[model samples]
Target: MFINVSDESITVNNKWERAELAQIEEISMYPVALIGDVLQRLGMMASVIRHVAGKATFFGTVLPILTWEGDNLAIHRALDDAQPGDVLVINGNGEINRALFGDLLGEVCLARKVAAVVIDGAVRDIQELDAMGLPTYARAVNPAGPSKYGPGQVGFPVACGHIVCNPGDAIFGDRDGIIVIDRRLVSSLAAKLKLQDDVENNFRARVRASLG
Candidate 1:
């Protein structure tokens, strides 16, 4: 269920299922690189989208926002529907000339308990965002600001960082980059992630023993 407010140039989808808290917690134990390995490296976002500020890792259900190039009016509107465990995944059309997110929005996200933010564009205020410790990543950084005039959509599928992201999808991000997982796959992938993690841990233990 979604609402299209033509006058406002925004569309909001009101219905999507979030994964269980336990499931999200279970998956968060693994690194983003390990999860990508388990997924056969299919869901990893482009490397150009690097961690810019805040914590290095975060995991949450996705709240996808698609905005016009270099504009972020949709993001402001999307926050009205944001939940604590939600991650704001914005597809800013890969525009890096203007920052679509910054410290002000970072504060808002902190207050709302947003799990993380990944922008397929640009963001600014790196120092404040880092101090605030909200996990944030983007394609680039520019001090220039963004336009509020929106022709955008929220809760819709967005192509962020060269990968398609659907609302309610599970997102895990780290220093390497972001990965999108389907909500339906969380349970099944959780087991695979554990198995792979165990394999890597054993390998590391073996290497340490050899070194000793």
Candidate 2:
């Protein structure tokens, strides 16, 4: 597996093993509007990456940045090296002119057991991808194809909305929005998230009784 020198220590561990992951996934199944309120209190932004028109939740490590107007070399490389719970985050500037992904790449990712892909760009071959049950989040859908030029970077920090993502940062996305959580902060954040849930549940019960 190819790895950048700086990310040598970044072992690809299954973050789902952490109790926090299950907790987060459980919370995510709730109404997104409610989740947004919780995220706001937690000081996290929900980065939206809409597909052409479908529903799916994507969770994985952020392999940040696939340079605009260039090939997906870094993405391919990252896919080769990525473990099961890794997402390929391509910052395409929301360009709908060209497709950043297709069935071929998706197949490789599926074979490798990649978690999902989040693109602030275009993706093609929607039906095939959907049928395969591959979780892909992108800004738009266009038949336009991307250039396969050489040169790109991986395992580095990149931007998605107002957040910066390192290669191994845990990424969570559903119909609501994409949330990037720093792996180091998971333990602490988990505690706070539970508190938020408790308050919300209490509020729900009160509202229910009022309605009755």
lDDT (Cα atoms) of all candidates against the true structure: 0.89, 0.64
What TM-score, over all chains together, does every model reach?
Answer: 0.93, 0.78
Which stretches in model 1 have alpha-carbon errors above 4 Å?
1-7
Return the lDDT, model 1, position 137. 93
Q: What is the C-alpha RMSD of each candidate to the true structure, in Å?
A: 3.1, 5.5
Top lDDT hit: 1
lDDT by residue for model 2 (73-181), tens: 5566567566666678777766778887888788888888877887777889998888778888877788877765435566666675556776666677666666776
Query: What lDDT would candidate 1 get against the real structure?
Result: 0.89
In order of listing, the candidates' clash counts read 0, 0
Tens digit of per-residue lDDT, candidate 1, span 1-212: 12233327788888888866579878998888899999999889999888989999999999999999988889888887899999999999899999999999888888889999999999999999999999999999999999887889999889988889988889998877889998889988888988898999999999999999
Q: Residue 32 of candidate 2: its Cα lDDT?
A: 45
Model 1 clash count equals 0
